[model samples]
Target: MVAERKTHPYLSLMNSYLIDSPQPSSISYWYNLGSLLGLCLVIQICSGLFLAMHYCSDITLAFDSVEHIMRDVNYGWLIRYLHATGASFFFVCIYLHIGKAIYYGSYRKPRTLVWVIGVIILIATMATGFLGYCLVYGQMSHWGATVITNLFSAIPWVGNDIVQFIWGGFSVSNPTIHRFFAFHFVLPFILAALVVLHFLALHTHGSSNPLGITGNIDRIAFHPYFSFKDLITVFFLVLIICLFVFFSPNTLGHPNNYIPGNPMVTPASIVPEWYFLPFYAILRSIPNKLGGVVGMFSALLILLFLPLLDRSLYRGLAFKPLSKFFFWLFVFNFILLGNIGHLHVEVPFINLGIYCTIAYFSYFLIIVPTISTLENILFYLGRSNK
Candidate 1:
């Protein structure tokens, strides 16, 4: 009986995938984005630790401490640059990972909570990054904080109070810096928690693979095949980050930020970090203060509703021509908005923003459903041949 059991089917299959699964047939590096995202998180955390060593939490010395690190501490400039550039890279990976989810319908049905948690993590990351930027305490830092927190003033009843409470005064100051530091440290742990929860949820539903296929019988185990795949991805990501850390550490930061915080002087145009450009465009697009706030936040809020909005019977965008068109259109429009956000608000820019913003929403709320129906019609007619 023991000899006969040597080839047990279920155990043998599990062993094949865990000890070894057949090498992936045809796959691209894009499939490694999820693991690349994981690698980015690790980089952010490690660089943040070294920077934190010299990062003074005290209000009086915070700016000077940054200077002292750069001027005196060994390789302090390197540490600072790595942390800053890493932030931008982290956002890049995050957006790609999120896009991967959207294109593959990873947000649908059983994986709804996974996507929802991912949104929450993105929001927290935004908050964490904003706080990190503010901690730099440059003119851009002050102006960025001033503009962003002041948006709360658009609230109907308790707007001013909320803003004051957050600022710890009428404007950004000592309390703001201290509080931001507190939250910056605290929120990442929250993010780490959300990531854990996100992973747990992903396991429950399994990942939405490239082919967008359903069922698990044909699915390979996650251990060996995926583990090695993730390992290779992580290695490549580390190499890229190291090149930046060594060669172009300051490539992503603004030149103005090198200057110390000055309440009297403001930069010609205060732009938030690049990762925030699309929402910044949405914020500036509307003329009204409260309306702009609503529009800005709604852009991100709209993403949370995607699973519900994409009613297409087909899962992957690749197979659905109409859906593919809208997906690319939406992506291009978003990139256009990000570009427009960086420009001075000219008539052409504003007009472009208006058109693209409409196109952006149309891709999600309107075009998706319309084309989904069209897809169903096509499928129905196509089936008649069978």
Candidate 2:
């Protein structure tokens, strides 16, 4: 039975995935965010597939079917809430993952493509999340879509055409709901593909650890060491998710969505899902509809160019004194934008939105480039690199 050839060791290269490499440093909790993102993707997909079994994409019966699953199917509520809450958790993980990248300089040099893929994932997730919100066919979902799609009209020349074509008609209706659901169901797979691209880039450059030292060969393998660490975080994550599913399933949800879609009634406030509040604020900051939309999309588009924005010789947060301050300030500004996004788009809120939107872009356009320049000057002056 043993007919193995002497030159056949490389034939089982796939087996190497399970073995640990010695390239990674002693990573901590921050390292878990990327793997946790992968876990969330799986949870979201499974929960969604189950819910899809009972979901009726038809606008007329969509709300009724969701109600039926709640009232009739055994433990359907648990599954539905898990899927819903998984979404919020998913974005939180990505935010932390993105921050981890920034803090440790994972976006520099060889890992820039990884960062690029992450941004693409971020945008795609937002697009699908927006569509997913509309799939519920509730009053809030309807009006939320109305407010969001109207933003496309900000495009100047062909904005109106883009908006109408996307909706499959002049307004949000059955066609809109159906298309949203189809896209919602489809986007996560595309996200998974991007994730594959991301990991390939990560593997090619090797993972950037806390020290932000990527070129060192004296590190640990990803198989046993990193995978074991990630598995521990996965358990804790599930515990948190289960708490939301079993206890406060409705906590993150708007009460208005409980009611079925009603054209005669409009919700007092048109807010998006909580995860999208920051960009939602950016969108509403402008007085003009098309302008608001452009601002929102452009804000994200700017992130794709970050490798050029920052030109510092050093990458980690600890060494760059000036860059460190601006980084934290920008983080706070982002959080503030999210808080303001939940408020009514009036007076003080609009004013705050305008400032935050400007500040938001400035962090990339000005603060980042300025700090990087300051670092280079300091470096040339022999200020400090140690």
Using all chains and alpha carbons, the TM-scores for the candidates as numbered come to 0.91, 0.93
Best by TM-score: 2
- Candidate 1 per-residue C-alpha lDDT over 1-386 given as tens digits, one digit per residue, 9 for 90 to 100: 43333378876644543444433333346768766766667767787877788888676788888898878989888777777877888898888888878887878888899999999888889999999999988778888988899999999999999999999998888999999988987777788888888877766656665666664546564566677877887887778878887887777777787788788887888888899988899888888999999988888888899888877776767688778877888888889988888888888999888888778778878887788888988998999978
The candidate 2 region of ten consecutive residues with least summed lDDT is 1-10
Give the Cα error of residue 231 in candidate 2, in Å. 1.7
Give candidate 1 misplaced runs (Cα > 4 Å).
1-28
- At residue 140, give the lDDT of candidate 2: 89
**Whole-model Cα lDDT per candidate?**
0.80, 0.83
Q: Give the TM-score of candidate 2.
A: 0.93
Residue runs of model 2 more than 4 Å from their true location after superposition: 1-14, 215-217, 383-386
- C-alpha positional error of residue 88 in candidate 1 after TM-score superposition, expressed in Å: 1.0
How many clashing residue pairs are found in candidate 2? 11
Lowest lDDT 10-residue stretch of candidate 1 = 17-26
